[model samples]
Target: MIIAAYNAQDTLVRAVNSALGQQVPVEVLIIDDASSDDTPRVAEGLTRLHDNVRLIVSAENGGPSVARNRGLAEAQGEWIAILDADDAFLPGRLQRMTGVARRHEADLVADNLLFFDWQAQAVAGRALRLADDHVQQVGAADFVGQCMTGRSPFDYGQLKPIFRRRFLHARGLRYPPHLRHGEDFAFVLDWLLAGARFMLMGEGLYLFTQRIGSISSDSSGQSRTILNLQAMRDHTLGLLARPRIRADRALAGLLSKRADAIRDQAIWNRAYPHLRARRPGALLMEMLRDRRSWPMLARHLVRRHRARMLAR
Candidate 1:
């Protein structure tokens, strides 16, 4: 298991313990990304306590992608699993996921997530509904289509996958370091495109923690988020331009739509400050500058209005 940690002193132990508590024997590699807090100290403690746990500290802070890539490079496991610093695995998660992987001959496997609200200290809900206890094969087109912006509250990209290490090493697969956000989606998209036999299980074994100031929820980092979205948009376009992607008509169409959606999101992020400040003139100017964002803005307004109406 590879965990990329940054300033995760408060929750690192819980996450590491969960991995160690698994029924099967597992090696945990914690990559500390130059944490400003005592995360490295905590990770060091874990390393000392558990012989199977190792700590790899980076000299500089390069975000999760860089840390995860470093862990991937040093990982010796046949199957590689990613665990977030603040999140954890439920009991038997690895054993069950690996079982499904071996039974289906899958290169990558992901299970449904159990959303945990940190503040509430309770389970919020399940990420996906498991209609039946069966594994589903995820096609490249289907995966890309589900990732469309505003398609759902839960993103398919959020699924943390356990991958066959040999398959990744053979294809030289690694997270895109340029993207602080959406890197998982990009990596998984690339994996699927590379002919990975991706399988999704209905079991919710991963605990996905929802923290108020987390990267995805924090609005103060809007500019950084916009840059990430732009990078993702460019990445999608690059994929669409590939001969293999273009040959798959369904996948190509979805990729094109995803690119447009990402562009719209970046534009919306740019305009959000004006909207929040209640500066109609500034918001109008921003909208006029990027007329392509109008459809997305309209959809947003409609959704808000419907939500308000339903509240009544």
Candidate 2:
């Protein structure tokens, strides 16, 4: 398991412990993102005790995506699992995940995750429980489409997913180190789009802490989230524009749905108690306003019209 941290002094140990306490033997690589805090000293101490635990201290501060990319580059495990600094894993997280990976021969395996409050209280339990029939062996193209279209639940909690290092390397996959918010979405969505064998383990093995000062908890600038969403939108559209990737109907459908998902999210971030306050229609129109987006929006409208005709 690879754990990435950015000045996560208070929570780093707990995150590392999660991987060490696992029932099976595992190595925990901790990447401290040039933290100004005592994270370096803290990590060094932890390494002395647990041989499976190692530390990668960055010379300069980089974002979480870069930190994870660094760890991904150095990871020796065939199966790579990511544990964030503020998040902890269940006791048997790795054992269960590796077991599923082997059994299914999947390139990627993700389980459900739960969130905890700052005081270590459970805020939400058993989140992302895939339906009983949610297990799927979709083609590579199909998987990407589902991710882009919001047909599947892929969120920050996906940090817990175990990835096949060989497969990821083969596809030249790495997180985009620039963006903060949409980095994971960009990375995971692209992998799915590239047609990886993605499997959901249907177990909850991650504990996401929602502390007040945490990045996830911070809804800082209204524009910050917008930039993140825009990055995701642009990345998806670029992929959709590819002739080969779009030739697959599943991938095309996914691109269209993901665009709507992005536009829908823009409307939702605003608090609106009335229909007039919501801009879903306007957002859809704005998405279509872009000449690049018109084709995707048109295809969606066409599909809806066909479905309506069939109903009539």
Candidate 3:
């Protein structure tokens, strides 16, 4: 698979290292979005040391989606692995993930991730509930259900998931470049709509490195972010109009997934205020107004109940 980045000088080395260190011998293709840093230089130097790691420098910066598209074109592996430039992979990530792909004959394998809080600690996470992988006679609803939940114990942002290259090409699938926010989410939705069987791994093999000043979180470019969310929602809603959605097992999952995507937008644009630093009172009020916030609020209640259960 391909590891794509733009101006990711500080974390690029570790990202490349993780790809190279995969249990399966992988072609760790690195695409630099014409970074104005030492990323290209560093990649250049490493090419001599590692034959698996290949570096390509783009003439212009087309963003990660574009960079990823470029890498997808050049990847030779039947399965493609994606790692953001900033995220690092734990050892055995590729081995376990690829093994799943081979066993289930899955088109897409979305695995779990261990998130590092701002302090870089292993905090509480959620269950993935990913359905079993079935390739030949895959159920659309079951497949889409796993993908829409958005949290399959996996961090979708990480480049640790494996994609069947032949499946991807057959469907002519590619990420939406214009979306600065949930572009990956949108792409996955389209793939699921087209009957991509998703397999989830419970293990969190990827490390998500949250960086400050990222385009998605930059208050300075809030318009672009908002537009991206709107575009994703609109795109997903359009999928519902397609002839599919007839799968009995996945109807609920599809609706839930749509709601979850909206809720995600809410978390970034609305629910963010609930934090103490962002003015909890106003945030709580907004959450009260929006029904989408209830699931998150219910999660809090469930956690509190479990805590009480343990204490008693």
Best by TM-score: 1
Which candidate should be chosen as best, given lDDT against the real structure? Answer: 1
- Cα error, residue 312 of model 1, in Å, equals 19
Question: Which candidate, 1 or 3, has the higher lDDT?
Answer: 1
How good is model 2 by TM-score? 0.73
TM per candidate comes to: 0.84, 0.73, 0.72
Which pairs of residues collide in candidate 2? 140-195, 144-192, 144-193
In candidate 3, what are the lDDT values of residues 7-50, reduced to their tens digit?
Answer: 66666787788778877878888898888878888888778889
* Global fold similarity of model 3 (TM-score): 0.72
What C-alpha lDDT does candidate 3 achieve relative to the native structure? 0.63
Q: Is candidate 2 or candidate 3 better by lDDT?
A: 2
Ten residues in sequence with the least summed lDDT for candidate 1: 217-226
Backbone clashes in each candidate structure, one number apiece?
0, 3, 6
lDDT of 2 by residue, 1-312 (tens): 777777777878888888889888787899988878788889999999888888998888777788889899999878888887878888987787777778888888777766555542444444454653344554555444445432243443234568899989999999887766566656776677666777775566788664321223332121112136666677767777777766877767767777777765544333222223456776566554554454444544454354334323
Candidate 1 overall lDDT versus native: 0.82
At residue 6, what lDDT does model 2 achieve?
A: 72
Better candidate by TM-score, 1 or 2: 1
